[model samples]
Target: MAPLESVRQELSQQFPCRKDQIQVLSTLFEASFPSPPTTVVHGLEATGKSVVVRAVLQALDVPHAIIDSKECITTRQLLEQAVAATRNSVHQALGTGLLHGNQIKCETVNALENHLEKNIKDVPKFVLVFDGVDRQKEAPMTLLPGLARLGTIIPNLSIVFIITVPNPRLLHLPGTPHIQFPTYSKEDMITILSLDPQDIFLERVDEERYDYGEEEASEDKAWLWPRYCAVVWDSIGKGAARDLRTFTLICYNLWRPFVQPIVDGTHGTRDFSKLLVSRRSIFQGDEALTGKIISAKPSAEDQNNRSKPTFLELPYYAKFLLCAGYLASYNPPRQDKIYFMKSTERKRRRRGGNAGGRASKHRKIPRHLLNPSPFSLDRMLAILQSILIHPVAQTGQISAQIATLTSLRLLLRTGAGTADLLDPATRFRVNCSWEYVSSLGRSVGIELRDYLAT
Candidate 1:
């Protein structure tokens, strides 16, 4: 009781805003037995799932092993790693318990089952944590169910899963209770990051200051870091790096220079307006927003490249699919048979002619100016097949490419039935502009104006 209370008091301060999770995990493990065979700890990446769980176990001084799921590429590898890690934990906790690595032979699940049933009788309550098992290379469906069943089957053992994606389908079995670590709120993030104020000038010792300036300077830095974090969140974190890890990295990268003017005595800490005006590049630069390496210094050529608008890098077929979507939206359905016969016939187009001349002089609205109309999946597919010189080997590949385009928002799925791909009439519209799609067409050596029915 004293130990649990002491650990609770200590860990609560070490990890702010995770009191509930710490309490739940502590209670579960401190009980007569950590019941229910399996406990799931799920959250978005960098939300402190792994670190919090680790802190609790270490603070409790409990026997545990955290095996990274990335290390387990196959079920055989997973089993071997699991057994070795479990045995190592038992030895660490009890000092002289459980069979050693060489003594326990496990190349398969059955061998592991035999070893566990025969040799794990004298060990204390142990927790074996698999971090990011849901993201492992081996399929979680087959791998996890078997592992969860093992936890149920084995005595004096418990399994914990730390996962990024909180999919219920993967955790639909009995006796599996999950703990969720939500994304950090603005206040919590600011509080957590205020732990260490960056050394703007790297705290150079040779640089001299006032007698009590050390104390006052420390006070000022503490005051300034939280405000800087707030400004960063308002300008960048709210839209781009919401996760703690990336947000923290970005802050560390930018902090040194952001406060250099203040350190030089040119601007006071409160003059954030002057600082923002002088360092406007930090806010508007694409490298910070586009996920370039945090500490990476951009070359002169890279800086030149950043000045240009970012181009979406798509798969070879995805470009054609997007082009077809644009054509289907702009061209009249009646002209489809004339321009693009069936999949078998060659497309008909005059060498130097484009249907752009077919527009009415007083047509109220230019086709490009009007919003795109929705076209069926079949219509887009027909246009895509017609435009290509060679027939695609399989439509499964095409369906996948359409899904990719939809995700990138180049093609927007329309109509009310939840955008079911199984429905042949699932309609989509072009979300790109004429100039954009026209440039895309020219890149692939096709003129988009030749197919328009304006």
Candidate 2:
């Protein structure tokens, strides 16, 4: 119930430098009240760029106008909205509606210039924070020139434009200062987590049924403490600092239901088994480990099954992981237990097809893979099935494959594959053992015999 302390802490850590920047600009603005504005802070999303500007304004105790650049419906709409907001905020603050009575019929850039020149007469210094600038249709290139021209027309109108975007390089704004948003380090992540109140942490602990048994409690401080750290770390590593807010929300959601029941006396420590099962359910379904083993047979309707599954058609992240795993197997210094790649030769042998068959004319090679032509996903799946049944390969190899397959299943179940999998920036790496993989496959209704026989 207490306001989140981390937000405040993050603000405090960022405001000092930002305050100095605002202070200098404020001084210049005060000197140029009847003249043009000066300075602009611009950067991408989650970079604390907007936060810095807002914090500065707050510290200065000076009134400023903020235009939420994300609200526009289209490129033209964006320009219109921005100009309108700028004029309205200035008009409201200065008690003068210089451009209010007349319908200023002009282009976005020109109109904004006209409003600034005509309306900002004799007023003291003020700043404009343009958050969500990337959401605009155009890069505000026209507005920039207009802004520059204002300095000559009105010497005292010192204006500092703060533009927040996801990509700074694309802006091409001249004479503007660019700031890069830093990625959150592990220590930063921990600090962010620590900002949560003691009650929140306790609630998460209780909800997850994280209490240790008498024997384990005496031996260690927390139940599954290492596992907890790994999970939190993994979540944070999935994206940049902007994602921290979402990561915290996920933790809160995961912990909320379990803790509330305990507090209400509707649940107790004896119900830990159910809580454990529930937590597992959040990540993976109740699928047998054997289900992950790939198997293939000439289908009863084989004539209709001409299309092969290609890796290119797969989500980008999945393809990247599969490729990384395949490459890792041939190479060394692997992060996982063992990476696996299904041999095309083995698949041909199992299907009684020629091992030296000509490359298919229709197969399209993905741009990332240098190969002239790439095997389809169905073909890859078939090859994987063959590897699962190979006598020369250890059962552990097959098991490991099954585990990777199971992780993929979990990703799909969580709907993570829909977006994250499609993103080129996202990738997956499984650290599970073969035994666990085999166990997971069985849970999902796959049989070891099917894998071995095929």
Candidate 3:
């Protein structure tokens, strides 16, 4: 085991967001150094189990052998590998002549214990690290229990088993002191991810790096790197499994799309924040820049002239279904049309048509300002069929499209209501923008310009 101070120092340098784990592990290593009770370290994948344990052991300058149990097929193979690793470790540290022979075969537990005791006499203790013990259990290898009993079987030797299993009972090794590493919470993840140097590279890039007249009053905010890293974690890291390595990898990959242009002056970074928030600015551009050229002789060429919306890539029927749902939700019924009427009767006198409802209902509201209202699935389907120019949309096609939309969160099912009691009725609401809905409608030859408020 290593000195407590040095172990803590190494941990702080290499591992972040695991102060509690590091503290406890440092104590364990210090107390168990030179000789150990069987120690089992288990946690979720990528929780830094192997890294922490190995770091502490190395800090203490212990003679240790690390082997992955995954490569061992049987008890014999495990024993051979562990003994070989231990032999190699001892041979390197103490040189030749320490053991009777350099080649020590471990065919039995007794022979292994005898070999370890005789060969590892030079070091204060010998650490045998078995990584991926869960794999060894699956191999049904009979070596784990024996290794767990190493404290009594051999003196001056300790065994460490690293696993991903949460329950120590699963390993069937009773009385072994097991150290559990919990998965990182979102806040913990953010803290750890913020410390990564991936985002710092962008801030410190040669061309983009700026110095404030004084350290405290620099035009570049000191918080920019942390804030940027936080946004990345919130945008992409949170959705994935809480693994530091994986999160850092995602942030690394995002540097080009999100940070490169800003550094290269191809695009400005001031307005770029979250992925979705800065999407148009980072990827899309002004209408004039993206507008397609029109041909004087138009023959089936109009489709290519208009700038297609992002949702244009959706399946054909999914597009029409979204447009129909949008109309059904945003456009009120004929009787309630006065609610959305452009002018009141008093105002119409200044203009034209006599508004015939509560005067309050005739308040002018822009179509674009209207929020999507929940509508029955049947009504949406009816609108879809009526607006579809092609008869290819069959019942199966409609059902499949609705399912797709629901999965994509473009259509959401609301609570069921009763009226005629015509089976289990479902209600749905369009969950996207008027611009997107209108684009879909236009793509399918249905004019949605009149249906939307704006």
The residue-level lDDT of candidate 3 at 237 comes to 61
Q: Write the per-residue lDDT of candidate 3 for residues 1-454, one digit (tens) a residue.
A: 4457777876876787777777776666564544456788888888889888888777766678898877877767777777877877898777653344455567777777887787688776677888997677335444566667776677777788898874545545667677888888767766776554343233444333653233332323334545565666665566653586776665555555565555566544344454346443432322221224743346665666555444547888888878878878876665234322334642212222346743453557665577777888777766666567754545676677778888889987777564432222677777888677776677768777644433
Best by lDDT: 1
Off by over 4 Å in 2: 1-44, 74-76, 79-83, 95-104, 138-153, 158-175, 196-231, 234-242, 257-454
Instruction: Quote the positional error of residue 295 for candidate 2 in Å.
Output: 28
lDDT of model number 3: 0.65
Task: Give one digit per residue, the lDDT tens place, for model 1 in 1-454.
Answer: 3578788878888888888988988888874555558889998888889999998888777778888878778766777787787776776677775554363446665677666655456666677888988877756456677676667788777889998876666755765788989989988888899888765445643435444355666777788789889888888888878688878877876887788787787887678788878976776664665555464576899889989766677788888888898989987798888777764766565433336866445535557788899999888888988888688864588878888887888888777845476467788888998887787777787887777765
lDDT of 3 at 384: 68
**What is the Cα-based lDDT of residue 442 in candidate 3?**
78
The candidate 2 region of ten consecutive residues with least summed lDDT is 329-338
**Angstrom error at residue 155, model 3:** 2.6
TM-score of 2: 0.42
- TM-score comparison, 1 vs 3, better candidate: 1
Q: What are the RMSDs of all candidates, in order?
A: 13.2, 20.3, 15.4
| Rank order (by lDDT, best first) | 1, 3, 2
lDDT of 2 by residue, 1-454 (tens): 1122343344466543333444443343333233234455655444456666665455444446666666654555645555565567567667665355554444565666566666555445545555565455555555555554555456544445555433443434455444444544555554555543223124233323755344543233233332333354554334422555544555544454434444465554445555455455543321211123533244656636556322213332333334323322222233112223343323311222345896555654332233112222233333344334332332444435434554665222222343433233333333333344344444434433223211
Which regions in candidate 1 have their CA more than 4 angstroms from the true location?
31-34, 97-107, 204-209, 290-454
Location of the lowest summed lDDT over 10 successive residues in candidate 1: 204-213
RMSD of 1: 13.2
